[model samples]
Target chain A: MNSVVRYFTDIYKGVTSLWTGMKVTGKYFISPGEIVTEQYPENRATLKMEDRFKGEVIMPHDENNQHKCTGCGICEVNCPNGSIEIITKKVPNEQGKMVRAIDKHIYHLSMCTFCELCIKTCPFDAITWGQDFEHAVFDRTRLTRVLNRPGSSLKKKEVKS
Target chain B: MNEEAVKKVILKEDEDYIINMGPQHPSTHGVLRLEVCLNGETVKHMTPHIGYIHRGMEKMAEFNTYKQLIHLTDRMDYLSAHINNEAVCLAVENALEVEVPERVQYIRAILDELSRVASHHLWWSAFGMDLGALTTFFYGMRDREKVLAIFEESFGSRLLHSFNTPGGLMHDVHPNFRKHTREFVKYFRKKLPDYKNLLTDNIIFHNRTKGIGVMDKEMAINYGITGPSGRGSGFSCDVRKVAPYGVYDKVVFREILYPEGDSFARYKVRVDEMQESLNILEQLVDDMPEEGGYTAKMKPVIKLPEGEYFQRVEAARGEFGVFIVSKGEKYPYRIKFRSPSFSNLFVLGPLAKGGIIADLVAICGSLDLVIPDIDR
Candidate 1:
């Protein structure tokens, strides 16, 4: 008699459990407000990425077309994957002295891991993260960007004696 | 005898056949191939072939600096990327003997719990899909996206955020970090019951899972199966409780355990653990310091003293250990990662020996094996 009683109790528990599960799903199914999926490409026009998003590194050029980069090559040295490369050449300064100046600052977007190490280690505060993230390119060579513009020069600062 | 008779005779002689499940099957999760020898639908034995996704992470770690290596750890257990990053950071911090600030510790603990919850959410979705509950995939991902959004708000990247550095975090939390976390916690607390109702209470799920893949306590310990899987078998291997790191010692959360040692028990352990993680997050988030330094001051170049160091942290999957052998250089002499999924994958053969092919799937789902972590 006890065995039969236990059997019915077990069946009741199983049936109730399944019913409870269905009720939860049913609630969600009826209420479309709970739906969380975003329609991609449709919302692209208004989609906003966070300010902290590390999309790509870019050197900010001022009105004078001069940047803070002193061509120290710190960012190139700090990049783990050798993503950044700086080409330097000797240029005549105001005192007719030959000093190292950046010819070209090449950045390979494909090799970069968005680690922010380059920006963090840059003593000149030359490079900062750009907000634009749509970086898909048809040709692989397009990913390699020359950051410094033509005729751009390093910013002039008063030398301390 | 014709070809049919000959084949029948050959089959009769052995009475068993072999089959390959995947290096690419959807159910296998990530590139794990299993060779199963079967006797009339019953799995006799199984051999798991890993290393398909192995990128020689340890070998690569030897060439990279300690700080650079943190990015590579993100790829191993991508689900628990933050925790894996924390392990390397803790290991380096211990070697340097730099005391991490209290704010950093609390923040790390909170983020660790958030990562745990997100990982379990993905596992739950995938596990339900494995068991033929297709809607669970949608439900699980829906909830997981909320957590990932919170991660993106502060850490910038959603999945592989190498936010944790050697001494502390890469940057301080965002202004909305606390508000977003509080909102997620509140939202998830209500949705958690819905998860319980949908899967936990379902008789079909119970029928598929309960008493299917039983691993006893001794066997679990012997195989070094830590995390929820080991706790399901009644082995007390919660690293957070046994060897507390960061602010784990300050939090009050139960280490969920079950003696059943079956697939359902393992499933139950993870479900209960999600709640505990929420509790831990709540405690730390409420008491977090408003103003403090995010990272400790360190030398530009980090060179560990010549010695060996190992640090273990409870990742969502299991205990992830980072072993480093330093020779007082920027790069380590040798580095190895003791990934939990590798050890956990081995026990599948033993657990599925006498079970059917369907049972094998159930067992694998319960184990929650992340193939890259195994491969690494």
Candidate 2:
């Protein structure tokens, strides 16, 4: 008789416990606007990434097609994976002395882990992280991008002033 | 009733059933295969099969520089990625004898606690689903998104953030870091009662979890279970309290323990921990210093002195320890990661010995084994 009474008590407790859980869910069910999920494709136009988002590396060039990269290969060395390659060419400066200058700043998007090592280690502050995350390409060669534009030169102090 | 007839009948009785639970099954969580031997519904004996996802991180650590090695730790316990990174950084810093600023310590603590809450939320969700209550999944993820958003805003990546460098953060946190963290704390506190109502107080959850997979204190210590799982057995094994790191010594928070030593006890430890994490966040946000260098004056090249250095940090899961054997080179000579899951996963065999097959899933979920951390 005691066991039978305890069984009924257990059933009562279980039902009430389940009802409490249901009430929490029921409140969310009635409010249609409380849904937190964003429709990703439809909201692409207004989708804003954080300012510090490490999507991809880019070399910032001025209006004169002059960049700050000295092609010292610090970024290339610091990179855990060999994602950045600095191809240097001997170019005569204003003093007529041949010095190493960046011929091509090759950035392989496919190989990059977006670890921000290059940007953090750059002595020249030439490279910065871009906001473009859509890097899908059908061709593999398309990802091996040269960061500095063709015919671009090193930015002069006068140009900055 | 003769001897030959009796012997034949005994031999002809069915052998114990053997079954493989997972290397891909959802309940196993990651690529962990349990070769479970069963008699009727009860598990007779179990052997865990690992190394499906082993990337040989320790061997790879030998080739990479200490700074580069910090990123590799991120992949080990990807849930508590920041804390793993901190372990490596702390080991390197301690070896180099660099003094990390108080501000850095405070910020690291804040981030650690935030990740703890996020980790517990996911665990709670997944544990519920493992026990056949699917509603907890959506609620857990919904609340977890806010914390991940905070991580995404500050660290620039949501999940595997190698934010810690040798002595300090790679960069200072976002200007709105404190504001977002405080808001998340206030917001999460209100929502926690809903979590309790939905799962903690539910009788179905209790029936599924209570008195299942009982691991006593002696067994937990013997098996080296070191997180909330061990604390569930009242082992007093919180690395934070044992060896305080990253402003943990300064904070006033209880090391949650329960002497019940069952699946439910482990579940309660994590649930109560989330509130304690909120308390930690509340204390940290207001006191964070406005001005400080994000990183210490680290040389461009880092080389640890000739010795073995170890660091242990209380990760979301358990005590994550990094052992570095340096030959005074930029790269460590040999690296060994004392990952929590590796120790914790082996206990499943002992815990699930007499429990039903369904209860095995509950025991495994309560243990909260992350396979990458184990396999790495």
Candidate 3:
């Protein structure tokens, strides 16, 4: 008789405990205002990434079509995956002596882990992180981009003064 | 044929039933394959087969410099990414013998507690789903997002923030870091009671977990299980308590323990730990130094002098140790990581031997085996 009473009490306790869990869920179920999910594609127009998001590497050019990269290949050397390559060519400096200058600053987006090693190691602030994360492409060659625009030269102030 | 010969043949025909639990299954959490031997629904013996997701991180560390190696540790035990990064940083700093500022210490303690709470939230969500409570996932994720948002705001990455450098942080934390952390602590404290109301008091949860996987204190010590799982068996092995690092020496928090040595005890240790993490954050937030620079004077090229160095810290799951052997080079001679999951995983065979096959999931979840940490 005592075992029978204990069995029923156990059932009652379990049912009550289950109902308590349901109550917490039911409160959120009835109120749609408590939903935390975001509709991703629909909200793309207004979606704002954090300012410091390390999406990809970019070389910023000034209005005079001048960049700060000096073809030192510090970024190329510092990159763990060899993501950056600075092709250099001979050019005349202030004294008219042939010196190494960046011909093209190549950045491989596909190889970047976005670890920010390059940006941190750059002495001239030559490269920075771009916030645009949409990098899908059909051709693999498109990811291998030349960061310096056509006919862009080194900044005047960036030369050894 | 003789009747005795026919009876012997019939008895020999029934062999041991063997099955594979995962290399793709969800309950295993990652690509861990368990070869479980069974007899009439009772698990007789089990062996965990790892190495599905091994990326050869230790071998890769041989070539990469000390700064670059910091990010690789993030991949191992990805949940405790901050603490993993700290292990490498502390190891490198100790070899270099550079002392980081008080501000860096205080900030690191805050991030450690925040990531610990986030990791516990994820474990609670997945552990509940393993036990057939689906609603817990959504609730757990909802609160976990608030912590991730705090991380995303400061570190610029949500999951694997490799923010720690050899000397200090890669950069200073954002101005709102303290304010947002305080807000999260206040908000999460109120919701912790809801977690209790939903799961802790539920009789079904208790019945499913209560005396299921019993691992005693002596076995826990023998296995070197040094996390919440070990603490569940009343073995006090918190690295922070045993050997405090960073600002851990300044703060006061209890090392949560339970003598029951059951699945429920392990569950309660993690749940209670989330509250203790909040206590740590509260003590740390207001007391953070306002002026000290975020990073110390670190050389551009960090080459460790010579000999070996090791650093251990309390990860969300257990004690994570980093062993580095430097021969006065930019890269390490050889690197080894003493991950908790690798040691904690072997004890599962003994714990699950007599239990039903269904209880295997509960035992695995209680141990909280992050497979990549094991494989790496």
Candidate 4:
């Protein structure tokens, strides 16, 4: 008689547990506002990324077409994956002394882990993370970017030091 | 009972067969292949093959600086990325004898719990999908996105945020960090009961999980299993409780345990742990220090003394330990990661034996093995 009572108790507990589970789902099903999925592509225009988002590396050029990079190559050395390469050449300064100048600040987007080491290690604050994330390209060569703008030169103040 | 009769029986048993479950199957989570031997529907044995996604992280660590290696740890257990980064940072901090600020400790502890909730949410959804309850997948992902959004608001990456440096955080918490965390805590408290109603109390879930893949306390200890998987067997291996680090000692939370040692018990432990994590988060967020520095001052380049250092943290999955040997160099001489999934994966073979093949899936899901963590 005791065994029979225990068996029925177990069945009653199991059934109630399941019913409670269904109730939660049922509640969500009736509420259309509770749906959390976003419609991709359609919502692209309104989509916003955080201010601190690390999308890609870019060298910020001032209005005078001058950059902060000194071709010191600290970022190149600090990059764990060899993603940044600084091409430097000797240029005549205002004092007629030959000084190092950046020719090309090449950045390979494929190899970069976005660890922010390059930006953090830059003494001159030459490079920073750009907010643009749409970098999809058909060819692999397109992923390699020259950060220095065409006809741009190093900031004279930075070279004076 | 004669030798001839036994020989005939052996010949008839040759119908038993073998099958390979995955290197690509969704049920295996990541790239893990299980070689299973079966007699009709019942599983006789299982051999797991790992390393499909191994990127030689430990070997790669030798060539990178201590700061650069933090990024590599994130790839090991991608779900527990913050905790993995924390383990390495803690090891380095201890080696250098650096004291992090009070605010850093509080923020790190809060983020650790948030990552735990996110990871367990993913596991719960995947577990439900493994059992043919597809709706749970959508529900779990929907809730998980809230946590990811919080991560994105601060650290700027949803999955792999290398946000911790050796001394402290890479950056301070966002202005809205406290407000958003409070909102999430309030929001999730209302939703957690739904999780219990939807999965924990479901009769079909109970029928499938209860008494299946039973592992006792002795076997769990012998196998060196830690985290919720071991706690399910009543082994009491919560690293946070045993050896508290960060603000773990300061906060109040329970180490969830269940003695049944079955699939249901393992599932219950994680579900209960999610609540405990919420409790911890609430306490830390409410009493966070008003003002402090996010990072401590350090030399541009870090070099540890000539010795060995080991630090362990309770990751979302289990105990994650980092062993560093430094010969007073900028780069570690040798680094070895003690990942929890490797030991937990070994228990699958024992648990799955004598159970039906379907039960094998349930058992593997309960263990919640992250393959890259095992491979690392």
Candidate 5:
């Protein structure tokens, strides 16, 4: 008789706990305020984020598409993963003397770890963080981007000069 | 006849049976070996042997470039890949003197919370299975798949996603990241109560778990427990709120806690934590910064300035600490990863000494022992 009473009591307790837990879930399901889900993409017009969040990097350009990068190769040397490469050349100045200019700045997106060490090492204010994230491509070669263009036609260079 | 039956039931003295729970034991979670000394059903003493799954990540981090180590961090807590990546990225970002954009910080916080929820769900499912609740295994996996789908859509990889870099994120959030994460959290939130009802509220599970493998608050503190494991014993040590990294402090969320220091309490801690995680996700989806300069102007070839920096982040398991020593070079001199599972695994021997064999399994599951976290 004692064992039978103990068994029934244990069953009652088990059922009560289970019922209580289900009630909490049911409350969320039944009430409109309980369901705290927000639809994405459809509601992306209303999406938001904090101000100081980290994203992808970008090289800032001037009105004439003039980039400040001198191609000093500091970013390449500073990158731990060899994600940056720069080709430097000596161009003839007004005095017919050879002066250094960045010929090519190659950025391999695949290898980039985005540590941001290069931006700090840059003596010339060149690369900055970018916010464009939809860069998915089927071909890996597309990720390797050239940041510098041939010939310098810039008003900013005259200001600095 | 009664005396003869009693004699048959008596144990034969001096006879010992050894059952070795090898590194392959399913219930052991990772490659943890245990030599069980048993006299019939009662376990005399259990000798747990570890270090089978050691990847020597700390030692390896010394050779790999700081950038390369981020992927290795993913292997440490394979389930919480984003959290591990965040810890490593935060360390390198600090060392390089790079500031993350406000938008990326919020994204990291949201993803880390989602990872925590997914990890807890996996733990609950496996713990129930350890306790002989077979139905929970299917239910747990189904819920975990929802979280994984969100991870895939946002990070491009479900597990071991090396999505975070030193300065900030590898890429900005996919245009659909916020929408997918919110949807996943909603569905997962709806499904959690079923788990509670099926397992926690079940009579057999409660009777078997409650008061079994009780851990006092003092022992829990002295052992340096954190996350759900520490919360089970009332530690309330949540790094997200404590240090406020990656925009976690700016957001509103509460750390779930339980005063009881038993196996069931630990289970409750993780269960309630999933809900809190949902709460954080809800807020993140509602307040995602849509437009911003996501990544800072950190150079492509990053060299760490000479210095020692300690970075701490709350992983799904507990506090993950990374201490990096650099000599103003591309490679770091020393990288030490203070893993949460490594510390939590120590409590098992002390907790399991006098408990039943089944209770040992209970404590192991409650502790949420991830072998890679221990081995890392």
Candidate 6:
């Protein structure tokens, strides 16, 4: 008699658990507003990521192409993946004093872990982040981009008004 | 046989044969080995042999720079690497007195939740497979792959994203990450019921699991089972709810509870926890702050101040902790990791006794033992 009661109680609990779970499933399954899916490539334009999402390493340059990078090797030294390589060359200013410039800023995208250590190490806010996440290439050489602005590498200082 | 008659069999089948079931079995999850003494198909005693994957991470942490050690953490519990990274970063930041930007903190919270969801997805999928449901395995991978794609877009790594840093985040959030998360959450919200009807409501699976591996509230606490496993025993020991690290305190979410403390109950608890995580993710995506994403900055070599710092996060498994002792040098003095799987794996012996050997896999699955975590 006791075993029978135990058995029925177990059955009751199992039934309740199943019914409760199924009720939730049934409700969600049949709901009108329940359908939620987006086709990946089809919805490419609308593929949303958070505004402040961190994606890739970027070096920011001013409109005049004057960069904040001081040719400081801090970013290169701090990178865990050894992806950043900064080569400094000194150029003579109008005042005839030597001004250090970053000759070649090489970033190997393949080896880069994107841990952001380079950004953290930059005392100057020279390197900002970019969101160009889809950087795959048919050729591996496309990943190693030199850190130099196209038109103007570094603009010369104009006379004060 | 009746109780009196069963005494004869119990007495006669004394020295049961012991078969070791892991440190290698796919069902053991990571690297846990269970020594099971069985009388025919019935389990007499079960002891879990662990520490095979002990990387001496804590001791190694003491020697490596805080920044270098963060990478080391990515290996400890490889499933939820982001969460592991976040927990250690939180502790290091606390010690350094670095204030994370509001936006960064919020994003960390969001990513942590995403990690939780992903981890649970694998758990549910693997748990189902362990119990003989092969289709759930494919479904799990399909759903999991979507999140990994999103992760790759957001953090540039699939399995182990060391996105979180000591001071703050490496960079600001990607513009697409929020939208990606929103869509992912929406997608998972729909996929959940497909999960339910496929596995949860199955009468046969329920029969196999319901009464097996029962652990009440007291036994659960004593055994140090945590995360969903402990909660299945009615202990709401979520560090997010209790301690409120990162941005969890700012939001409202339910502490999912299952009072029965059985194998089925724990399994059900994880499924509910995933829903709860989705709910939190929805709220977080809707209201992610725009201010403060990066901390001030750190040295190039990533030096640390001298002191001991301990940080704990509510990982999908349980309390994932990192204890770092800095010698005020480039490298740490010591680093000790308290993984949830380690403590949770210790309970297998008591759970397996008197249960059928077939139920061994089921009970282990319910506990969600990720062996790398136990071994680490």
Clashing residue pairs for model 4: A21-B197
Question: Candidate 4 — what's its lDDT?
Answer: 0.91
Query: What Cα-based lDDT does every candidate model obtain?
Result: 0.91, 0.91, 0.92, 0.91, 0.78, 0.79
Q: Which stretches of candidate 6 lie over 4 Å from their true place?
A: A1-161, B1-15, B299-305
For B75-184, candidate 4 gives per-residue lDDT tens digits of 88989999999999999999999999989999999999999999999999999999988878988888899999999889878899999999999889899999999999
Better by TM-score, candidate 5 or 3: 3
Chain A TM-score vs. truth, each candidate: 0.81, 0.87, 0.87, 0.84, 0.77, 0.74
- Cand. 2 Cα-lDDT: 0.91
Error (Å) of candidate 3 at residue B243 is 0.5
DockQ of predictions, in order shown: 0.67, 0.74, 0.69, 0.68, 0.11, 0.10
The DockQ assigned to candidate 6 is 0.10
Against the true structure, what is each candidate's TM-score?
A: 0.93, 0.94, 0.94, 0.94, 0.72, 0.73
Among all windows of 10 consecutive residues in model 5 chain B, the one with the lowest summed lDDT is: B7-16
Native contact share for candidate 6: 0.06
lDDT tens per residue, model 5, A1-161: 99999899877887787677567546545873542346866876775532222245567777677888776787887675678888888877789998787787888888875555576557776886554455799999999987665564222455553
3 or 4, greater by DockQ: 3
CAPRI rating of model 2:
medium
Cα displacement (Å) at residue A133, model 6? 15
Global Cα lDDT for candidate 5: 0.78
lDDT of each residue in B296-375, candidate 2, tens digit only? 88898999999999999999889999999999999899999999999999999989998899999999999998999999
Model 4 regions lying over 4 Å from their true place:
A1-18, A158-161, B1-15
lDDT of 1 by residue, B120-176 (tens): 999999999999998789889999999999998897889999899998988899989
Best by DockQ: 2
Model 3 regions more than 4 Å off: A32-35, A93-95, A139-141, A158-161, B1-14
Task: Tell me the RMSD of model 3 versus the true structure.
Answer: 4.0
